[model samples]
Target: MKKRWVLLVIVAFVAVGCAEPLTKTQKGAGIGTAIGAAAGAGLGQAIGRDTESTLIGAGIGAAVGALAGGSIGRYMDNQEATMRNQLAGVESASIQRNADMLAVTFKSDFWFDINSATLKPGAYTELQRVS
Candidate 1:
């Protein structure tokens, strides 16, 4: 109950942009910690039904989740920059980052032969760049 209220207040403040802005890493940590804490508490209650267990679960979850989240965010940032630099002149492919995942989309029209399912000769070059 107390944790929920504190989370709500923090979310409201962030939503309204009243507080100093959060970087992607900071945002990831906050989100991961909140989600992990909730999951941990629920699991602890289901397994142990004890206060000590719940507190321990929450603490462990918060630490692991925050570090993992920050690391993922940083990895995505670096990958996005690399993709943009590597594919600078290639207009047929697009790269997207959603949360911790990266989506690389290539237009078939740019990579495929007309009326055939064969990959164009030049497409290999772009694919090699990506690799």
Candidate 2:
């Protein structure tokens, strides 16, 4: 069993190393799979000493985690596209996404008056609609 596990690991490493570069979603899934496998192995060992239990746990964890991670990437892609379209012709705001988080940044010059912390007059209405 230990040899089998070692062989599996070697095979997996070789396969991935020989493969083409992964996309963002694929990278997310790979990260998820690693995390999930570790968690599953820990849980499996705590519950039982058998390989079957470990494999089952790992499978379930990988499936759930991969789906979640990949879906999040896809969702971010969709949102970024939407944001780009929505902000078209409006250069003051920009949207950025990395992994699971999204950020929308607005140029301070557009919202604040010079040398003042207070918002410029009529800024509230446009900002409200954007938000």
Candidate 3:
């Protein structure tokens, strides 16, 4: 009976360890892609394209958005490490697993230009290096 109980406990532990954790990055990407696709489709329709064109545009936009988000996540991870080293006063940073990918979120103040969604030249350079 004791041996059976021990085996059950071990099995439970293993199950817990093997369970997949939910990932915010994956969720964000999915939501972002959906929104982007909708917006793309709307724009395509306004421009007098057919349903087929709208769908194609949506697919392309979703792919590009996912790639951009993934790239930005990686860049932020690297930037966090660099900042930690240089500042030495900042909190430790970590990259979380997101499905088969890795992700990191950054403070908006750290990476973006004021009133602009476009990446700064330095940020673009870093992203290029990453790619």
The prediction achieving the highest TM-score against the true structure is 2
The local distance difference test score of model 2 is 0.78
**Model 3, 114: alpha-carbon shift in Å?**
38
Give the per-residue lDDT digits (tens) of candidate 2, residues 1-108. 999999999999999799996666777777788788778877886787889888888887787778877876566567767777776656778877654566788899
Task: Give per-candidate clash totals.
Answer: 0, 0, 0
In model 3, the Cα lDDT at residue 17 comes to 96
Candidate scoring better on lDDT of 2 and 3: 2
State the lDDT at 109 in candidate 2. Answer: 95
If both were scored by TM-score, which would come out higher, candidate 1 or candidate 3? 1
- Better candidate number, 1 or 2, judged by TM-score: 2
TM-score for each candidate, following the candidate numbering: 0.58, 0.62, 0.40
TM-score ranking, high to low? 2, 1, 3
Candidate 3 TM-score, C-alpha based: 0.40
Question: Could you tell me the lDDT of residue 10 within candidate 1?
Answer: 90
Q: Which window of 10 residues has the lowest lDDT sum in candidate 2?
A: 94-103
Error of 2 at 93 (Å): 2.1
Stretches of candidate 2 above 4 Å error?
1-24, 97-103
Residues 1-131, model 1: lDDT tens digits: 99999999999988878767565777778888887887787777778899988988888788878888787766766777888788777798887777656688899998997799888899888889876
